[model samples]
Target chain A: MTDEAFEQALINLTETMYRVCYAQLRQKADREDAVQEALKKAWEKRRLLRDESALKPWLVRILINECHNIQRKNRRVIPTEDVMPPPPPEDADGVMHDLILALPEKYRMPVLMIFMEGMNGTEVARALRIPPGTVHSRVHKARQILKSQWEEAQKE
Target chain B: MKQFPDDLSRAFGRADKEFVYQVQCTVKKLSEEKRKERTMNKKIPFGVVLFLAILLLAMGTAIALTIHNWKHIETAMDIAVENGAYWEWSLNAKIRLIEAMAEDGLAVSEGDMAALKGDDLTEDEKQELADRILTEQYGEEHFIYYYTIAVAEWGEPQTWTLEQRYWFFKTEREKGLYLDNSWIDLLPEETDLTRDEVVRIAREAVRSAYGMTDEEIESYAPNVSFFITDVCDTPRWMVEFYTQGEDGQIHGSPYSVLLTRDGEVTEDWENLGVLTPAQARLRQERQKETAVDVFTMRGQMRLQDQNTVFWNPEGGKHYHFLADCPMVNADKLPLKELPVWDAQFGLLTPCPCCVSLQDFWSLKDKLRYDVGSWKYPGPDWISEEEAVEKARAALEEEGCSPEGLYPAVYSTGALEEEDRYIVYFDALLTDPDGFTGVDPIYYAIVDACSGEVVSCGESESNG
Candidate 1:
């Protein structure tokens, strides 16, 4: 693909890349690191990308891998004091958002893509390297869990 | 308030405007590279090949004779010495090798890769950049990470974890330590404390935690491995205690305590690492209780309309820094979001298991906590007196008087595989009014361990 076309495609998905990255990494600096790393990786290996249509989901996969890389760093480096200091939940919406964050990674990722960013099963499967069937099943199980909890909050 | 899916999406979908702008800049910057790859796809025409073959055939005999004489090893060496033909070739070859490596993924940053792969940079500029990247910043992060790991793994370094950098340096490069003293630039394991003292500190920490005596601790058979925690970073000891809990009790397996060279426990990791069947079940039961605590806290906040925060309200317990944060429960609520002010965070403590939140503490905080000398550990070999004695002898041999000279030594030559005890002799003159001045007459470079006086001369200040 031409550089201009690649540039336009990536530009169009700026918000999407942001949403997916932010969902996995809460810290702004980490999110920025993940994005920059993913973009650089994508640019260097753009030739390996055989299909133009796969660019968006391809970028998502790169971003997800980078986020996991940042998270895996917890095991190796010495952590510092002070909280990550997530902005406090103002209302039920914020609380629900934290619930999604709280979900185990397998469920949290699909939930963010399918419900949050409106990505369909095919895109998620391609991005996550899972079959479409598995994507829907995980999303279904996650939704059931979220639904029961949301109902409890509504009653409260 | 919105309903289930909408409310959740509302929270997760929102990205701060600055984040969106940052992504824009990054993507735009990456997309502008003039990709110079895809050379293999170009097809060569038979006509061009035939013309080149005919041209070479016409001058083939003369070209072969010229090449055969010059390519000989002895002749090549002579040519290199006479003029500088071989020197230019050697330098150009190294620069080309660097470019090839960078193109193959040694270059961590986007600009390095772009400059090597594009037609934008002149030959001089490319050579200069490659030299700077190769020799400069040897002890900094991201410098040799990809190159070292790629050489070790022979696979893609980009896909590898950041931990691999330290792993390669600590274990894989141990054999190469003597072969090349290049590790000196990256190692500042300078501490006055002996290995025995550091081990004792670790042993005491384990003994106190398990409530065991030294003999009892010996039964567990604790093992220690020294490694760099961060690449181009400080050296740490990963002390692991082998065996499991007694009588099928659940305990931290291969229990580990990370300690600094200055003997400070980085965190309170009384429990961490893998889990056995019994340990998993016990952890589940413990989580059930935490879930209940969080559930009650959440309900109270909902009912009272309180602006709550989420933490282990307990002052001494660890707050998880990982994605699998311990506050989140499988069967129940996530965190019991509390309402503690930033000023009231006196009780919160750092996690011993995952000391991952580096940004939370500033560099000043790290320095204060780490407290390592970060000097070369050459003093461990020979004593200061030995170095001074060698220096005094060298001075005496040179017919120089040592009557008024007091010797001082340092280990600053390790950077060049020359870990020499550089001793300087000083003569001080004290005035009657209590003022004093000092003079240095001679200096000596004594081999740290071998006790050889490598070089001895007058002090630079004396001249």
Candidate 2:
């Protein structure tokens, strides 16, 4: 493919990639960071993806891993600014977004792949290199967390 | 969570665009740095190879001379005796011993081990001595060939066998080691070279050997031609000459030749530098064309067919082409004829680099397919008559009202808004210092389509 065509492919993949990252991390800043990091890695290893047909899958896989890595690192750094009142109701839906970020990485990854990207549970399992049953359970646990968090926020 | 954020998709899209843009910018910067790094890496390997070659050549010449001269051999042997001969020896230890002893004033005859054991030598010395004896018995050629081989293998000097003798003589003559008086030793009669009669005879002998009638060698070489003119006890003939385009004259220096006595070449007959006038002129005519060198304007280029087009990629100006010009890969055609079709056929998809013939054919094949139609347009041929008509129309369209328009105009086969191939030209210019000097005028081709020059001519501007 021509260099211009390859660039167009990158453009097409960017939106889906951003959604996957956002679903996994639940923060606009973190999703953007994850997308940028994933795209950079794909660009650096572009030669390995000479088969342009595989570029989207390749980029999506990388974005998922990068999201997981960022989540793991964020969890290790315990927040010190604490004992404050609940976050303000700015973008009301932003609360669900914040709760998604707080969810365990395992659950968040499957929900992001299944809901945001509309990938099947089996595809999510394959992407994560895990069993389809594990992916189904992760998605189930992610929905439970979101439902519970939404109820708590409503009560508040 | 909290009704699960409906506007998350919109935010995601905006963030995605920003992220892609940032990543693209970073990739562009990294690409430039990586290109520079690759260029530097390419030069390092070539430079290392060149340096190693030069070092080997110098070492070989030094070793060869040391081995050939018995005095150096004696000194080396003394050092070997004082120290251990095979201190740094390995698989070739046996060979080194044979060669060293043969050089150490040892006769090296068969069964001469008993004769060689007069001094209590180290294991290295004993081995070297034994090897020398074996070489003496088995090897021939007065140990000269052995020295040559040793120099070649160890020192790696770059010179053909035919040139070695001349190199040796020239080097020795320059050092004032060889003298003209040595030639008198080859004289049968009692000839006093200093006297008038002997000097006349010596001059006569030189004339006869060089096939010159009465013309002296001095007027030939140093003054006019490639002839050597260095004065020494031993003299050699060197003839040199070249053509002067301004004067339209063929000039040359005289040929220098060693004057031999009784047909025998001695140390004094080492060099007879200079050439006769006739020989100088002959050499001049031969070298005249070769002396013409063209210097190129680095990165500045012009196409042959297009005059107004010029480019300088280094200067950072790109003039978009009116139409893409395809440079034909002339090598693909048979020697009998140039590849006229490709030369005249401009490619629709012109890359920054020259159009490869294989790419042209591949493109042509793909033009009928859906993928090919979307990527590359085809059929870039302009007929001779149609091109002429177009040129006339273009000239008329400009309202120049010229008496005649050249029918040989070309079309850069691109849409009206598409970029055209820059016209590039190769030109020759006289050196600023003038033609009498060593360097010649520069030659170069400028790409006029874009301001960037594609290729440049050879440079001989070093004054």
TM-score per candidate, chains pooled: 0.33, 0.27
Q: What's the residue-level lDDT of B217 in candidate 1?
A: 62
Location of the lowest summed lDDT over 10 successive residues in candidate 2 chain B: B293-302
- The prediction achieving the highest DockQ against the true structure is 1
Q: Write the per-residue lDDT of candidate 2 for residues A109-146, one digit (tens) a residue.
A: 67766766667764565467566778888888878888
Candidate 2: tens digits of C-alpha lDDT, residues B323-417? 22222223422112112122111111111221111111222232322111212322443333343334334434444332321111112323333
Worst 10 residues of 1 chain A by lDDT: A74-83
Error of 2 at B299 (Å): 35
lDDT of 1 by residue, B64-122 (tens): 34322112222222222332211123434434445544444454466875785578998
DockQ of each: 0.13, 0.05
Task: Supply the DockQ value of model 1.
Answer: 0.13
